[model samples]
Target: MLVASNRGPVTYSLADDGTLTSRRGGGGLVSGLSAIGAEADALWVCSALGPGDREAVRRGVGEEGVLMLAIDETVHSDAYNGIANSVLWFVHHMLYQTPLEPVFDAEFRRQWASYESYNRSFAEALADRAAEGAAVLVQDYHLALVPGMLRELRPDLRIGHFSHTPWAPVDYFRMLPDDIAARLLRGLLGADRACFLTHRWAGAFADCCRAVLGEDALATTRIGVHGLGADAGFLRERAHRPDVEERMAALRAQIGPGRRAIVRVDRTELSKNIVRGLHAYRALLATRPQWRERVTHVAFAYPSRQDLAVYRDYTAEVQRVADAINEEYGTPGWTPVVLHVKDDFARSLAAYRLADVALVNPIRDGMNLVAKEVPVVSDAGCALVLSREAGAHEELGEDAITVNPYDVIATAEALHTALTLSPEDRLATSRRLAERATALPPTRWFLDQLEALTAVG
Candidate 1:
């Protein structure tokens, strides 16, 4: 078996002493694949993301069963930042300020060429590494072209591609150039099975194929949905570790005595809607002054895609709104909003365990794992204020206080309702949410796709 993604399960860093150090990654994919055990033969093909990675590749030093391609830096930047993050990400998330931005000019065409080269690198590597009739799983929009490119190189390989983002609606997706839109659909259809996170996204993909290439364009490829779920066992055990416990105590101190916490942990990505979430919290404090000193919004907005100007500007706006809220409602004894910008895993787990209400109101998301994770690890059951637009809402909406992501007023009321829930009611809802959230563990999710892909032959 072989897995291909833009990032692998491990990374390397250089030490001042000229020695290299390696660090393993943690996520659903890593957890799922690790459950397969070391005995199973597998390889993870990924790109070199930085100078350290490129050096490690050049020196032939890396983890066994992993291949890191050191493509030219300029090519990587154009493909990664120019096309993938700037263009494709915006289209899928429906995030364009359409009238003013997204100019598809000569520069875009050049970057598109680099995107093709980036994917071809991966395709060539997979073709060389795979055994006869090997099953290959390609992950996410970054590698959307790999399936088709690889098919042309090796017809014997069984390929599966999984999209971890919401597929844009038919009308929204048409923003791409005519040729580019058709090329993306055809690239995805190259797989024997194309998977999405939810039925809505799957339907959107099928609609796109029909819209771009006629009604029968989807006849050759099968569509599947496997909503990834939280790993309860891991979260349960990890939440009680010493580091987590220490962070939990520290967070409790910052939150003050008898104050309930509304927690949100997310990267400051455009679609996360962190700015609007802060607005909702501010609305809650303003409308219900009695709860002003009794609650604190603990937000962890870790910086993401900082290389892009728009992302940097968004991150700044998040801080600006958060600061404005704190400045407006804050007192020496009670700070209404407690914000953290750094990325810390143990600290996130701490926030998850201590949350009284978990706010997962992304404008659009593939599946907000935080929604599922908080319920599993909450010290005292947590209420969920979720966005209907998030894919996780498909499974958790019944138990959550669902809100329109764009409606700050409704979200504010929902947050208030979540904060005031009786202990027993909150506990019951949390139990149900956790049950639905873990219905398909990460191991099961990955294995299901693998099984489905291999079964086609």
Candidate 2:
């Protein structure tokens, strides 16, 4: 079996002492592969994403079962930041400013060329490594073109493509250049199976294919939905670890005593809707004055894709809003908002365990794992303030206080309702949410895709 993605299961770093140190990677793919065990005949084909990765490639130092492609630095950046992040991400997230943005100029054409090249490199590597009739799984939008490219190279292989983001509705997706849109649809169709995180996204992709390439475009490709769920066993065990326990103690100091916590942990990505989430939190405090000092919003808006100016601006805006809330409501003994920009997994687990409510209101998302993860590890039952747009809402919405991502007032009201729920009700809801959240663990999700892909004719 072969796995292709933009990043591998591990990263290499050059230490100051001139020795290279390796760090294991995190994410569903890594966990799924670990569950399968190292002895399985598998290779992870990924790009050399950093200077360290490039250096490691140059030095002929690499981990077994991993193949890192050393594409040209400039080409990598153009394909990564310019095309994948700037174009595809915006289209899928429906994030374009519409009238003034996404100008497909000369530079865009150049980036598109590089994007094709980047994907070609992956396809060639997979072609080289795979045994005849081996299964290949291509991951996410960054490598959308690979399935088609690989099909041409090795027709005997069973190819499956999994989209990890929300597929844009037909109308929104039409915003892309006509030919480019067709290419993307055709690319994924090259696979015997095309998979999405939810039924909504799968339907959207099918809609796009039918609309763009006519009715017969999907005749050969089977669409599947696999809503990735939380790993309950891992979360339950890890949340009680010594480091998490220590971080929980530290978080308690910051949160103060006898205060219920409203917690959110997210990277400051534009699609995450961090700014609007903060606005809703502020509105909650402003409207419900009695709850001012009784509750604290523990928001961890970690930096993400900082190399992009828009993301940097968004992260700054998140911090600015958090500060404004504190400045308006903070007292000598109590802070209304305890915000952390740094990313810390142990600290996140601590927040998850201590949360009274978990706020996961993304503008649009394939699946918000944090929404699924919080209930599994919550020490005290946590009410979920979920966005209707998140893919997880399909499963968790019955128990969650679902809100529209764009409606600040409604979201604030939902938060209030979540906080005011009786302990018995909260615990009951939490139990259901956790059960639904882990119905299909990561290992099961991965294996299901693999099983279904191999069965495809």
Candidate 3:
């Protein structure tokens, strides 16, 4: 089997002594694949982003039955970020304000050419490496065109594609120029089966294939929903580590007595609604003065895509909002908001363990793993204030206090309710949440998808 994504199994970093060290990836997909390393031969074709990655790729490094192939810098920049993030990301996440006309200009056309070249690179590589009738799994928006391109090269191979983000509604997707939309749908149809994270997303994809590519294509295209879940064993084991304990203790000490923690951990991206979340926290402080000193919001928003101007601007906005809230409501001894814009997985687990309320209110998300992880690792029974738009909400909705990502005042009220619940009620809610969160572990989720694909064959 071959696994392909935009990022590989390990990212390289230069050590203090000038040695190159590779750090394993953290997301559920990486962990799940690692856990099942003995099952099959897996070759991961990913983009080489930096000097370290390029060096490692050139060395033909192989470990844990995983092989890494890195694409060129020009292809990655123009295709991955320019077209995937700036174009398809907006279309799928519904981030654009389309009241203003969206132009498909010369730059977009140039980037589209790069996107095609990038996908062709992967298809060529996979074609060269794949055995006859081997299963090839392509991941996310970054490589949507690979399945079709690969199929053209090697007809005997079984091709599958999975979208890790929401598929846009037909109306929203139509914002793309007619040619681009048609090409994307046709590209995906090259796969024997395509999977989405939720039934809604799956249906949306099927609808796209039907509307854009014609109903005849739908007869051959198989769509499935594989709702991704957290790695429960990994979270549980990490929670028991001494470093996690120490971090939890430090966090508790900082919050002091009689103050509950409202926690959110996210990449510093516009889609996360970080600034709006801060606005809601501020709204809570201003409107409900009684709860001001008793609560602290711990927002750990690590920098992401710092090279992009929009992302840089968004990170700055997050800081400005956090600073403003602290200024308005902070006491000499107590800060109303503790904002850490860094990526520390252990610290994130510690935050999950220490949280009184886990706030996962994304404007849109495929699956907010934080919602699931907090319930599994939380020391006390923590209430989850989840956005209805999150893919996780479909599974955890019965236990979560649902809120719209746009309604700041309503979300604040929900937060207040979660923080003030009685101990018995909190415990009960937490028990149910933990049960739901861990019901489908990552290995089982992956196996189920594999089984479904096998059945399709």
Candidate 4:
């Protein structure tokens, strides 16, 4: 089986001694497939962006089994950032607020051409590596057109695609020019089966295919939902490491006593609703004076998508808000906000363990895994204040306190309620969440997809 995605399984980084070291990826899909190991002769095809990546790819440098392919910069940038991020991502995540007007200019068309070229690159690579009857599973918005392109090239191959983001409703999706939407739908229909993170997202995709591409498309397309879950064993082991313990001790020392920790770990991106989340926290402090100095918000916002101007602006806005909040409500004895903009997995695990309240309020997300992870390994039963917009809401709604991402007052109230929950209630809720988080492990997820693909074949 060949799995195609925008990012590879291992990323190469230059070490202090100028030696390249490969770091394994962390998502549910990666961990799930890794568990399957040699049983599933999985070949992951992904693009490489850096010089080290190019060198590694050219020299055939990587672990024994995985195959890495690096594409040119021009094609990757225009296709990935322009078409995938600017066009498809906006359509799927419902990022655009202005429904009345959308800009589809010459640059968009140019980028769309590059997007097609990028998809073709993957198609050609996969077709070469895959056996005559091998199954090729395509991933996410980045390579939507690859399945169809590959299918056209190799008629005997079985193809499947899974969208890791929410599928926009027909009304919102129709905002894309008719030809663009039709082409994308037709591209995905090249697959024998399609998968979504939730049934709601699946239904939305089906509706789009029906409304945009017609009922005839349904004859070839079968949709399924595989709700992604956390890897309990991996998270549990990482949570108890010495590095995590040292970080936890450092956090405790910094915050001092009688202070509740509200933690949010996210990439600094426009869709994360980070500024709004901080605003809600500020509202909590402003409206409820009692919580002014008693709560500390540990925001672990690492930089993401620095190539785009909008993301850079969003990152600045998050820092500005964090600074403003601290300036408004900080004493020499204790700082109210601790904003760390660097990516540190150990530090994140430490934060997860120490979190008294986990705030995962995204504007829209396929599934916020942090919502699941915090409850599983939290020292004190962490209260989750989740956004209704997150895809994880379907599975963890009962135990979580759901909030509207845009409503600052409601989010503030929810935070207050979460912080004030009794110890027994918190523990019970956390226990339920931990059970739900681990109910569907990663190996089960991959096998279920394999089963669906096999049934269709």
Model 2 alpha-carbon drift over 4 Å, by segment: none
- Model 2, position 177, has a per-residue lDDT of 95
- lDDT tens digits, residue span 1-457, model 2: 8999998887889877768878888677887777778667889999998878888999999998999999999999999999999999999999999889989999999999999999999999999999989999999999999999999999999999999999999999999899999999989998999999999999999999999999999998999999999999888998899999999999999999999999999999999998999999899988989889899999999999999999999998998998999999999989988999999999999999999999999999999999999999998789999999999999999999999999999999999999999988999899899999999999899999988988877
Model 3, runs deviating above 4 Å: 14-18, 35-39, 62-64, 99-101
Residue 352 Cα positional deviation in candidate 2, in Å, after optimal superposition: 0.4
Q: Candidate 4 residues 342-441, lDDT tens each?
A: 8988999999988889999998899888898999989878999999989999999989999999999999999999999998888889989989987777
Candidate 1 residue lDDT tens string, 186-281: 899989999999999999999999999999998889999999999999899988999999999999999999999999999999999999999999
Residue lDDT tens for model 3, 145-241: 9988998999888888989998899889988888889889988988888988888888888887778878786777788888777777788898889
Per-candidate TM-scores read 0.99, 0.99, 0.96, 0.96
Q: What's the residue-level lDDT of 148 in candidate 3? A: 88
Model 1 Cα RMSD, 1 decimal: 1.0
**C-alpha lDDT of all candidate models, in order:** 0.93, 0.93, 0.85, 0.87
- Give the clashing pairs for model 4: none
Q: Stretches of candidate 4 above 4 Å error?
A: 14-19, 97-101
Tell me how far candidate 2 lies from the true structure as C-alpha RMSD in angstroms. Answer: 0.9
